[model samples]
Target: SQTIHQWPATLVQPVGSPLSLECTVEGTSNPNLYWYRQAAGRGLQLLFYSVGIGQISSEVPQNLSASRPQDRQFILSSKKLLLSDSGFYLCAWTNRETIYEQYFGPGTRLTVT
Candidate 1:
């Protein structure tokens, strides 16, 4: 059984401040990981994805960055957050054999003040 975990279910950060969010998966190995952002009443937008360690694909060029240092640990970071960065951040993982279905963890809702 694979499961994912994300921290700081809700966050409030001042504009231009730094941001760091973490996500980890258990019971899986070398799964494809993804970071998505969803605004209020909007669909999700892919931020980044990783096929393996140190191999990341950025879907959008924004103020955020992602890193996969370990097999099951993924991190999202930003040097300077912007007001537009406020949104729901989600972490998802899917087995390579089953790429069509992805499991998402509880998202982190960020509000830039």
Candidate 2:
């Protein structure tokens, strides 16, 4: 069985601080990984995605970036946090076998101030 994991279930950061969020999957290989953010009462917005190691695709131009250093590891980082960065950050994964179904992690709630 495949499982996804996200760290720091909740975070509070001051504006202009650096941010790093990690996500990893177990029992999956070469899976497509995704990073998404959902503001209060808003839909999920795709931030970044990776199809393979070191291959990243950004969906929107923002203050964040993502990297896939390993087959099952994905990291999201920001050089400087913004007030608008406060939101629920989610990590998800899907493989060819389950391309239509995405498995999500518990998520990290970031509060920027």
Candidate 3:
């Protein structure tokens, strides 16, 4: 079975600190990876996505970036965090065969002060 993992399940940082969040998948190959941010009581916002290694698509212009250095690894980073960046960050994966069925990681809660 495939599984997705996200680290730093919870985080607290100042407004200008750098941020790095990692996500990895197991038991899947060539899966489309996605990054989403959900504000309290708000719907998830697609931040970034990758179809293949070294290919990243930004859904919105923000203070964040994503990279896929390996087949199953996706990283989200921010050079300087903002108060508005505080939210629940989730990583998900899906393959072409099961594109409708996206598997999500446990997610990380970020609090920017």
Candidate 4:
């Protein structure tokens, strides 16, 4: 069975600080990883996607970036943050052999003040 995990379930930061959020997937190989964000009362927005290591696609253009250091690990980072960048960040993965069914992590809720 595969599982996805995210850290810092909740975060509070002042504007202009750096940010790093991580996600890891277990029990799968060569899966397609994704990063998403959902603002309060809004639909999920795709931020980034990785088909493999060193191959990342960005769906949203912001002050954020993602990296896949290992087969099962994905990291999201920001050099400097803004108040408008606050939201619930989620990580997900879909197995290529599983008909593209995605499984998501618990998520990281961030608030910038």
Clashes of each: 0, 0, 0, 0
lDDT of each: 0.95, 0.96, 0.97, 0.94
Which segments of model 3 are wrong by more than 4 Å? none
Q: Which residue pairs in model 3 clash with each other?
A: none
Instruction: Tell me the tens digit of each residue's lDDT in model 3 across 4-97.
Output: 9999999999999999999999998999999999999999999999999999999999899999999999999999999999999999999979
Q: Write the per-residue lDDT of candidate 1 for residues 28-76, one digit (tens) a residue.
A: 9999999999999999999999999999999999889999999998999
Evaluated at residue 21, the lDDT of candidate 3 is: 99
Worst 10 residues of 1 by lDDT: 54-63
Instruction: Candidate 2: list runs displaced more than 4 Å.
Output: none
lDDT of 4 by residue, 1-113 (tens): 89999998999988999999999999999999999999999999999999999889999899999999999999999988999989999999999888558899999999999
For candidate 2, the 10 contiguous residues with the lowest summed lDDT are 95-104
- The TM-score of candidate 4 is 0.97
TM-score of each: 0.98, 0.98, 0.98, 0.97
Each prediction's RMSD to truth: 0.6, 0.6, 0.5, 0.7
Q: In terms of lDDT, which candidate is stronger, 1 or 4?
A: 1
